[model samples]
Structure formats: structure tokens, C-alpha cells
Target: MDWGLVLVLLLMGAFGGFSAGLLGIGGGMILVPFITMIFSARGFAPEVIVHMAIATSLGTILFTSMSSVRAHHLHGAVRWRIVALLSPGILLGSWIGPWIGKQMSSTVLALFFGLFISFSATQMLLGKKPSGGRELPGTVGMFAAGGLIGLLAGLVGAGGGFISIPFMGWCNVKIHNAVATSAALGFPIALAGTLSNIFYGWGVADLPPYSLGFIYLPALAVIATASVLFAPLGARTAHRLPVATLKKVFAVVLYCLAAYMLWKAFH
Candidate 1:
């Protein structure tokens, strides 16, 4: 184990966990970009770095989401009924997402991830809440929505909060409930995405040692451990902090990451 790299992953995990807890984002947005930079710095193969970053990020979210959602559940904020309704579709879509991603070149994958991250940042910066005059759709409709959310999140290595929160709010779910429910939904998205990515990345050439499919095992383990420890603290802070202001600051950081990915994609 490289102690230096372990330290870096620890710090990233701490921050990512806090952000996951506070923002209901499951930390993938932050993890994916940084993991890309780290792997690139380490001279991982260009063909595999982006895929590994995405896969590892999703794997870490498996732990982060569990920690964050447990906190949210304690607050009685999670809408389990909705989670049940959406998960089947989320699973199906998430499974397909990585398969599609595997077919894209690194440049194209990075470009796509960058674009979506920028869009998510813009939404955060604008602080635009979807109008709330409707109720959640029927099971079939929810399944379709879940599929779309899961697919996009898998592609970008997000927690599905970017799409799910807005959709929930649009359907008149309260903001707190939306955030909590999104956190709960992250598990299924991550589970399916991570597994699918692993399957697709199996037997790929030039993979790093200790890599399980596209996931760097060391990074995933370290990050998930660190992220889990901090997630509850972040969840506690979320109710106390001026989250709107924080979101703007986080959005700015995301813009910088997006710019980096764009540069990576092109050169």
C-alpha cells in the first residue's frame, strides 16, 4: 500500500462522505473527478482510468449511502414506499448503463461525464426548485422515472439525487423527504451499477493490480471506510447548516472538476 496515496484517498473519502450526508448526493460526483485525476497521475492506462474512476466511485457509494441513509432514516425522513416503487426500475436501468458506457471510448466517456456534472452544478447554483402541484405517479410511471434516473446516474457515477430530488419535489414531496428518499435510493443504483461495471470490465487489458473489474480495490476500501465514518456527522450538520450557501460553494467546486474532465477528454 502506498501510504501517500492512502492518505489522499482518506481525505477524499472524508470530504465525500460529508458532502454525501449533507447534500444527499452519495459522493460520486466528487469522487469520480478526483479519482480520475489520481489515476491519471499514477499513470494508469488511459483506456481504463475513467472507467475505473466511475466504477470505484459507485462502489464507495455502496457504503456511503448506507451510512447516510441510516442517519436519514433515524430522522424519519425516508419514504420507503417510494424506494420500493422505484428500485426495480432503477436496478434494470443501472445494469444497462455501464454496459453502454463500456462501449464508449475514454474520451467520449469523460466528455459525457463532464457535461452531466456541469449540468448538475448549474442546477445547484441556480437553486431552482421544481414546482410542486402534483402527486407521485403510479407504479408504472415511477418505474420509468426510476429507470431514467438510474441510467443517468450510472453513466455519471452519481447517486441519482440530481434527478431524483427534482422529480420528487415536482411530485410534491417535501424537500427533506426528497433528500432522504434520494439517499435511500442510492443503494440500489450503486449496487446495480457497480455489479454491471464489474462484469463489463472483466478481462479488460492493462488493468491495475488489485483491481476487481474496473474498481480499484484499495481505493474503494479506504474511501468507503473513511466515508462511512463521516457520513453521520454530515447528516447531523445538514439540518443545522445554511445548506443553500453550501450548495453554491460545492457547485463552484464541481464546475472546476467539470473543467478538468473536459480538459482530460480533449487532451
Candidate 2:
């Protein structure tokens, strides 16, 4: 293991974790592209680097989410009832997402990832608040949204927070509460996506050492540990900071990163 690589991984983990804690994001939106770039620069197989990056990101978020959710829960912002309503669909979607991802060509997957990031960036930039409504989404809408979120999570190895938070807000949940609940959703998405990645990549030959399916264990370990320590700090910061301003800045950063990833995907 190169010390440089380890250090880079740790820095990425801290950045990603801190972003999650402060922004109510899943961290994959930032982490995946960053990891892909690092792996590419390190001479990892171009064909597999994005997949591995996404999978490893999802695995890392499993731990990161725990810390984030705990902090949000402490603030009394999580909506457990909503989490219960959407969980089954999210779980099912997570299982199916990786299977779909496995069948796509690497180039196609890269393109898909680029597009997804672009969309997330756009959402962040717009920062449109939902019109207030207190009624929860109907059962059908809840399942449909959860399934969609799950599918995206599995395919992209994200925590689905970028999509989930806004959707919850539109469904009439308060923004802070929506973010908090979305953090809880990360757990199932990560678990299901990790399992799917393992099964989908199982027995593939010539993989990098210590890889479990698409995930790199060393990266996962480094990222997960550092993220867990920082996530609480981020959550606390969110409560104290001007979140609207922070979100705008974060959106700009995401747009820049997304543009870079798209360039990498094509060139």
C-alpha cells in the first residue's frame, strides 16, 4: 500500500464524511468521482474503476450514515414513521439496483454516473424549497419513490440523499426533518447495495487484491473509520451554520466536480 494512496484515501474520507454531516448528503456525490479520479491516476483498470469507486463509496457510507443519523436523531429531526413507510421499497430497490448495474457495459455505467451527478448538481444549484404541505405522500407514492431511490442507490453506490431529501420535502416534510430522515435511509441502501455488489462481482478474475466483489476493503476501512469520527461534527455544524449559504456553495462545488467527472468519462 502506498503511503500517498492511504493519505489520499483518508483525506477523501474526511471530506466526504464532513460533507455528509453538514450537508445532509450521502457523500457519494462527492466521494465517487473523487475516488474514480484517484484510481484512474493510480493506473487501475479504466473499465472497473468507476464501479469499484461507487461500490466502495456505498460501503463506506454504511458506517458514515450511522454517525450522521445518530446526530440528526439527537436533534429530534428524524421522522421514524416516514422511514418505516419507505423502508421496504428502498430495501427491495437496493437489491435490484446492482443487478441492473452489473448488466450494463462499463462505458454505459460511466455515462449514467455522469448524468446522475449532473442532475444532482443541478438540484443543489436550484435549491428550490417545496411549498408547505403537511400531508405525507400516499402509500403508492411512498413505495414508488422509495423504489426509485433504492434503484439509483444500488446502481450508483450512493446513499440516495440527494434525491431522497428533496422528494421528502416535496411530500411535505420539513427540510431539516427530511434531511434527518434521509440519513436513516442510507443504512438500508448501503447494506443492500453492498450485498448486490458482492454477488454481482463474485468470482470475477484479475480483480485488485482485497476486493470483495466491486468494493476495495482497504479503502472502505480507511474511509469508514475517518468518516464516522467526523460525521457528528458535521451534523453539529449544520445546526449552527447558515445552511442555505453552505448549500449554495456545496452545490457549486458539486457542479464543478460533476463537470470534471463527465470529462473523465469521455476522455
Candidate 3:
């Protein structure tokens, strides 16, 4: 393995993990675009690059989510009841999402990826706070939302926090609690997405060595290890920093990255 590539992966992991911790946004918004660039630069088959990027990003999220959730739990921020309520649907949806993704053409997936990123960035910039007065959604609604979130998670290789946090907040959950519960959801999302990717890409020809289906194991290892180690630190920093300012800054960065990704996809 090239040390240079390893270094790049580590840096990507650190940035993505830190952003996840600080903003409660899933790392996929960062990881997917960066990984796509890496794969493209490495001269991988254009047809397969997006799939590999999404799959690898999901695999890495498994570790980062564990670390982030644990950190939030330590601070008593996690809402276990919410996690329990939403997870069943999330798990099932996550399992099915990648399967659907596997059927889509690469160009369509790239466009979807760009649109989602832009939507997430707009949400962040709008500065919308959780409604904060109503009860959690009913069982059916919760499950439906979870299923939708999971499907997106698997298809895009995200932790689902981008959707989960906002959805929880809309249900009148506190912002902190919403983010905490979303963190817990990440584990299931990552697990289902990873498994689906494995099955979806199995037996495909001309894949790079060291791949487990669409996932690149070496990249996953380097990113996951580094991201996990630093996640707690990022969470701690969030407590001290002015989060609104951070959110705006992060939103700008996301927009820039999204633009670059769209450019790459087109040109």
C-alpha cells in the first residue's frame, strides 16, 4: 500500500470524524466526495468509482459512529427511548437502500449525491431549531421515518444523522437530544449499509484487490481507526465552542465541497 494514499485517507477520516462530532451531521457528506476524488485520481473504472466510494464511506462510518455515540452517551445526551423506537425501521431500510443503489446508474447516483448535499447545506444555513414542544411521533410515523432514513443511509453511505437529526427536531425533540439519538442510529445505518454493499458488489469482475465487494478494506481500516480515536475529542470541543458559528462555517465548507463534486461528476 502506498503510504501517501494512507496519509490522505487518515486526513480525510480526521476531518470527516471531527465534523461529525462537532455538528452532528453524518460524515458521509464529507467522506463520499473526498473518496470519490481519490478513486477517480487513482484511475479506477469510472463506472464503479461512486459505488466503491459510497460503500467504503459506509464501512468507515461503522467505527466513527460507535465512537461518537459513546462520547455523547457519556455526556448523558443520548435518548435511548428514541434510539430504540427508531432503530427497527432504520435497520430494515438500511438493508434495502444499498440494494436499490446497486440498480441505479452511476450518473444518476452522482446527481442524487449532489442534490442531497445541497439540501443538507441549505438546512444548516437556515438555522432552524427543533420545535421543542410536542411529543415524539407515533409508532408508525417513527418507523416510517426510520425506514426512509435508513434507505438513504445505505444508498449514500451516510450515518443518517443529516436526516435523522432534523427529523427528530421537527418532532419537537430538543436539538441536543435529537443529535444524540441520531448518533445512536448511525450504528444500525452503517451495519446495514455495509452488509448490503458486500452482497451487492459480490462476484463483480475487475474490482481492485483488497476489496470486500464495493468496500476497500485498507482504506476503511486507516480511516476508521483514526476517526474513532479523535471523535471523542471533537465531541468535547463541541461543548466549548460556539456551535452556531461552527455550523455556518461548516455549511460553507460543505457547499464548496458539493460544488466541486458536482463539477467532477459533470466534467
- Scanning candidate 1 in windows of ten residues, the lowest lDDT window is 126-135
* Cα lDDT tens digits for candidate 3, 91-191: 99999998998888677788788888888888988879655576678889889989999999888888898898888778877777777677778888999
Better of 1 and 3 by TM-score: 1
State residue 173's C-alpha deviation in candidate 1, in Å: 1.2
How does residue 200 of candidate 1 score in lDDT? Answer: 94
Give per-residue CA lDDT, model 2, range 111-195, as digits (tens): 7888888888788778897887557677888888889999998888788988888888777787788888888899989998999
Q: Could you tell me which residue pairs clash in candidate 3?
A: none
Model 3: CA > 4 A from native: none
Among all windows of 10 consecutive residues in model 2, the one with the lowest summed lDDT is 129-138
Cα lDDT of model 3 overall?
0.84
Question: What tens-digit string does per-residue lDDT give for candidate 1 at 33-150?
Answer: 9999999999999999999999999999899999999998999999999999999999999998888899999999999999999999999899877765789999999999999999
Pairs in steric clash, model 1: none
Q: For model 1, what is the C-alpha lDDT against the true structure? A: 0.92
Model 1 lDDT at residue 265: 99
